[model samples]
Target: MYTKKSTLALILTACLLALLLVAGCAQNNPAGNEAGRPEKQGAVTVTDFIGRQVAVPDNVERIGCLYAFSGHVVAMLGRGGDIVAVVEGLKRDVIMGELCPGIGEALVPASSGAVNVEELLNARPDLVFIRSETAANEGEKAKLEKTGIPYLVVDYRNMKEQMYIVEMIGQAVGEKERALKYNEYYQRCIDRVQERVQNIPLDERVRIYHSINEATRTDARDTLPADWTQVVGAINVSVNEELKFLEDKYFAGLEQILLWDPEVIIVNEAGVADYIMTNTQWSSLSAVKNNKVYQMPIGISRWGHPGSLETPLAILWTAKTLYPDLFSDIDLVAETKYFYREIFNYPISDQLVAQVLSGKGMRAPKGKAN
Candidate 1:
C-alpha cells in the first residue's frame, strides 16, 4: 500500500476523475463553458452615424426618440409602439398621429439641441436616439452621456447617408431585416429613375424652383433637395454657386427667384402653390404664367424634406411630374398603397390616399393657447 509506483498511479486516477466531473458539470451548464460559471450577458454594441460605439440592450423595449427623424424611422421599423419619449413634432405630425396611435402620449423631454435629463430619465427609456447636431452640442452631449443610458446619433446629408441611417436604426432596434428590405427598395427606386432618365440631355432637363415651407425658403447646394432634383434629371434653379448671397443660406429674395425664371415651381407646404399662382408679385415668373406651379405631396412626412424616409417616393413623383411620358406606366397610387402596406404595415384607404396625393389636409392643426 505504501509502494511509490502504486501511490503515483492512485494520485493520477483521482486527478483524471476530477477532470471528468468538471467537464460533465460544464456540459450540463446552459453556457457550456469550461469554467462552469454563467457568462455575463446584457448589451450589444452598435456604432452610430457619428461613430460613437454605444452599448444598447440586446432586447430594447422602451425607446426614446430625441429627434423626430429617428421617431419616424422607429415607426417605420414596426417598433412604433415601443417609443416612450419623443421630440415635440412627432406628437404634432398628422400622419404620424394617424399611423402610430398613442404616440401622443409619449413624453416630449427634448427640443432642438436641449435635453431635460430628469424628464428623460423619468421616462425610463431603454435606449435613446438623437440627431448629430444635438450630439455636436457639447452641453447636450454631456447631459446625454451623464444619463448612463445608451443613445445613438443619427445624421444624413446625402442619399447614401440616409440609407445608412435606416440600417443603423434597424440594427439598434432589432429590425435589421426590415431595414435591409427598405434599403433594397430605395436602391431599386434610384436605379429605376436613373435608367429612365439616362438618355435625357442636360439642356433638355426641366428648370425647377422648389420652395420649402415658406415661399422664399429654398434648398441650397449641399441640401437633399438639391441632390435629388439633379438625380431626377432636373435643374434646381436655387442651387447655383453664383447665388452665394442666400439669406440664412436658405431664403432667396423674390427678385432672385424671378431672375431664375424657373419653368416648373414645386412648393413643399400646403396652400403655397395657390399663393404663388395668384400673387401679383410672383405673377410674372415663367412657372406662374404657365400654370406649372404644383405642391409636393405630404405622406407620412413631407416627401421633399431632408429628414423624410419617403424621399424615394418624392424623387419618383417629381421625375414623373416633369417627364410624364417617361414614367407614364408607373401607377403612383398603387405604389403609394404598396409603400404603406409593406413598410408601415398599415392599410391606407382610398380617401386618405387622395388627401395625401392632393397635398390637402395633411398639415397638423395648430394647438390652442393653454
Candidate 2:
C-alpha cells in the first residue's frame, strides 16, 4: 500500500482538512478584525477634531467632562457616577439647581487644577472628555499627554459637525450602541425639521439676524455660518462679509448687525432682549418692526456642543420657531421630555420640563458661558 503517488495524495488531503479547521476556528473566534469592522468587539475608533485616532471605550470609569451636556451624554452611557467634574455646572444657577439638584455641592473647576489636578491624577480615569473646540488646542493637547491622559475635542460650529461630534463622543465613552440610538433620533429630528421648513420656498425663505449678548450686544459667528445658515435645508439671512466682528470673538454690536439687516432676528440668551428693546438702532431693523424676532434657547446658544444629544433638540426647536405651521403636529415639549428621560435616564417631572422649555427668567449675558 506504500505507493509514492498514494502517499502524496494522503498528505495533500490532510493539509486541506487542517486548513478548513483553522478557518472554522477563526470564524468562530473572530481572532482578527477586518477593515470596516469595529475593533475590540463593537468599540469603534474616531478621528477627533484635532486629528487623532482614539478608541471609544465601553466602560468609562472616572471621567472629566468639560461641559454639562457632555456629562449628560455620559449618563446616557450609564456612567454618570464616573464623571467627576464639569465646567462650572452651567452659569445659570436655576437650571443647574433643577438639573443636578444637590449635586452642585460637588466642586466644578474651570481648569484641571482648580480644585487640584491631584484628584484627577489619583482617579486614573479611563478617559477624559471635553466639549467645544477650544479645549482641543495644542496647549491643552500637550497638557493632557504630559499628564498621561487622553483627551478629545468636540466642534459644534456647524450642525453636521455637531452631529459627528456627538457620535464620536458616544463611541469614545463606550456607549457606541447608545450613540447609534442617539444618531437615529437625531436624524429623525432633522427629517422632521426638513418637513417643517420645506414650506418656505427657497427664494421666499426669510433672512435671519442672529446675535448673542454678553454684557454687550453682539453677533454670533457659527449661528449664521453653520447651524442656522449652512445646514442642508437651512437658509442664511446674512452672508459672511469681511467684518472686524466675525473673528474668533463670540460677541459684536447693533451697528454692525443692523448693516446685515436680516429679515428675522434670532437672539441668543444673552442680554439681547434688553438691548434690542432699548437700542433705537436695533428697533429700526425690519425684523424688529415685523415681529420676526425669536429667542434662541439657553445652553449652547453662544456655542453649541457638536456631539451631545441636546444639540439636535436645539436645532429642531429653532426650525419649529422658524416654521410653525409645517411643524404643527410635532410636540417639542413631549419630545424633549422623551429626550431627557432616554438620554439622562432621569425622569424629569412635568414641572421641571416646563421650566427647561420656558423662557422665564432666562439669564442675561454676563459673558459667554457656553
Candidate 3:
C-alpha cells in the first residue's frame, strides 16, 4: 500500500488531528489570554429566586435590569457600571440616580411589563433580570427565550425572601462574596433592633397606622409593612381581616381607622402627614392629638415599601421612632452616611444625609420621584 494515494491520505489525517486538538484547547481555554489581550471567562450556574436554574456567564459585564430591585442590588454589589439596560423609574430614584449616574443614560423599555424585544436586543446585555410576575407572562418569556439570552427572575414576598433575592442577584453577577457580606450586615441590623424591642409587652407596644398615598389606604396583613411593624414591636392597627377589601388588600375606611385610634401614624407619601394633622376628620385620632405623625424616609427606594432594599434601615428608624430612649445613641444621620459608604461604597453628601433623615423634599410618590 506504499502508493501516492496512501501518502496523501496520511497527510490529510495528520492535519485533521492537529485541527481537532486546537479546537479542544479553544473550548477549554478561549483565545486572548495573553498579557496584552482580553480575557474570556467561563460559565456559572445559579438558581434564581423562582427556582429556575440559569447558566450565567462569568464576569458578566453587561446587565439588563427589568426588575426594580435588580438595579439596587447590583449597585450595592459595586457593579452599577455593568448595567446596560434598565426599566423605567431608575433615573427618577434619588439615591439610585446618585449611586449609578449612568442609569439616566441607560436603555429603558417602554415599561416594566411591556418590553420591546428588538430594542432590548440592540442593547446587547449579557443577562436580563426580571421579576417573577413578568417572567410568568408567556409572551415575554417566549420572546426572551427565542433570542437565546439568559434571564433571571428575582421576586420576594417577605424579608427572608428579600435577603435571598439579593444574594441570588449577587450570584448571577459573580459577586456572591459581597452579597453574603451585605446580608451579614442586614442580619446584624435585625438582631440589634429585635434584641432591644422584643421585650416590649403587647399593651406597651406603640400602636401605628402606616398610611400609603391616601390616609385610608394602609398596609394589609402578610405585607412588608405588617412584618416590619411587628419586627420593631409596634402593633399595626390595619391588619384586621374585615378591614381588608380583598385578598391582600390594604384599604381601611376612616371609621375603622378611627376605631383603632393608633398612637403613631407614619405616612409614606410626602404631604400626607401634614394633611392628616390639619384635617378636622383626623383631629380626633390619638396620633394627631399627640402630634406623633412622622414621614417614612426615602432612600434608594421608599424604605417602608415592600420593593425596597432599605428595610433594615427602616426597621431601625421605626424602632427608634416608637421608643426614643431605647435607640437614643443611634444617630440616624451618622448611620445613614455610614450605611451608604460601607455598603454601596459611596461617600454620601451631608446635605442629602440631612434630607433623608428629615424625610423632607420627598414630594413625589415612591418609584415616581427622585
Candidate 4:
C-alpha cells in the first residue's frame, strides 16, 4: 500500500471486480434482466363508429370481414389482398367474385350473425371488421374478445357515416391516401348531382317509391333509398305516418302504395319491377301505367345497402331515370365506366355494365331478380 505502482494495480483490480459484479447482477436478477430487454411496440388505438376504443396492432396484415359491406369498402381501398376471411354470402356473391377474383382462393367462410371461432382462428387474421349492430350483441362481443383478436365496429347507416367508415378502414389498413382519394371522388360525384338538382322546387320534384324486394318492403324517410331520392331532389312517396318511424325498411301493401301513387317506382330487384309492370292491380299507379319502374343497379354490393359507397352512382342513376330530359347531359354509360375505373381501378366493359344494371351480375335467384 505504500508503493505508488502497487497502489495503481490494486485500484485497477478493484475497478474490474466492480464491473464483473454489475454484469452478474444484470444477468442473474430477473428484474434487472427485464429492464435490459427491449420494450414491445405499443398498439394503435382507434375509435370505432360506435365510439368504442379499439386497440389494433401497429401493423395489420391480415383482416377478416364479418360484414360484406366492410369487405366491399376494403376492396375499394385496393386492399382486397389483405382479406383473409369473409362471410359465405360475400364470398359467393357474383359481383364480389367478379370484382375480386383473387380473394376466392383465400376466403375462410365465417357467419355474419355468429362467430366461427375455429374457422376465424384458422384464418390467422390480425383484425376483424364487424357491423356495429352485430358488435352490440353481448354474447358475440364476449366471444370475439375470447379469441384475443381485435375487432373494430363500423356502421354505414348513411352517406356521411359511410365516408367516415371508408376513411376509418383506410387508416386501419395503412391505406389512408387511397381512402382520401376515394372520398374526394365521391364528394365530386355527389356535388355534381346536387348542383343540378338543388334548385328544383319541392312540388316540381318527382315522387319516387323504392321497393326493397318483391314483398313490397320499402325505405323509410331516414333509410338509404330515401336518402337517394332526396339527394336527387325527388320526394319519397313512402314517407307517411305509417312508415315515417319504421327506422329502416317496412312492408307495404298494394293498397297503401295506391294511396301514394308515385310517379316513379324504383325496385331493388328486377323481378319486382317485372311484377309491378305486369300486375293488373299495380297498373293504376302512374309509375306502373307509364312503365317508369326501374331496378336499382347491383354491383359488388347492393347500392341500397346501408351506407353504400355506391350512393353517388345511385343518385345519378336515379336522377337520370326520373328526369331524363333534365339529366340528359349525364351519359350513364360513360359515367359508369369512369366510376369503376377511378374508384375500383377496374375497367368495366359495356356488357358488364349492362349485367350490373340488369341484375344479372347480382346472381339473382333463378325466378327472382335481385
If ranked by TM-score, best first, what sequence of candidates would result?
Answer: 1, 3, 4, 2
- Write one digit per residue (lDDT tens) for candidate 4, span 1-370: 3699888999999999999999777545643333432222566677788887877776777789987778887887777778888876666656566566666665554554677776776676778998776787898888888977789997755677777888888887777888888788778877888898888888999998887755377776555566666788888877653752243447677798999899998887657788888888998999988888888887776566454667778878888887888789988778778777877887777898888776654663453311
Pitting candidate 1 against candidate 4, the one with the higher lDDT is 1
TM-score of each: 0.86, 0.71, 0.83, 0.82
Candidate 1: deviation at residue 221, Å?
1.8
Ranking by lDDT: 1, 3, 4, 2
Selected candidate, larger TM-score, 2 vs 4: 4
Top TM-score hit: 1
- Better candidate number, 2 or 3, judged by TM-score: 3
Q: Across residues 214-328, which tens digit of lDDT does each residue of candidate 2 receive?
A: 4233334454244544442445433454334544454444466677677776665545666676677778888778777766554322322222346567667766676676667
Summing lDDT over every window of 10 consecutive residues in candidate 3, give the lowest-scoring window: 30-39
**Model 3 lDDT on a 0 to 1 scale:** 0.81
Error of 4 at 197 (Å): 1.3
Task: State which candidate, 1 or 2, has the greater TM-score.
Answer: 1
* Model number with the top lDDT: 1
Error of 2 at 364 (Å): 13
- In candidate 3, the residue pairs with backbone N, CA or C atoms under 3 Å apart (3 or more residues apart, or in different chains) clash, namely none
User: By TM-score, is 3 or 4 better?
Assistant: 3
lDDT string for model 1 (121-151, tens) is 7677778999877888898888888977789
Q: Which ten residues in a row have the lowest lDDT in candidate 4?
A: 31-40
Q: Which lDDT values do the candidates have, in the order given?
A: 0.83, 0.58, 0.81, 0.75
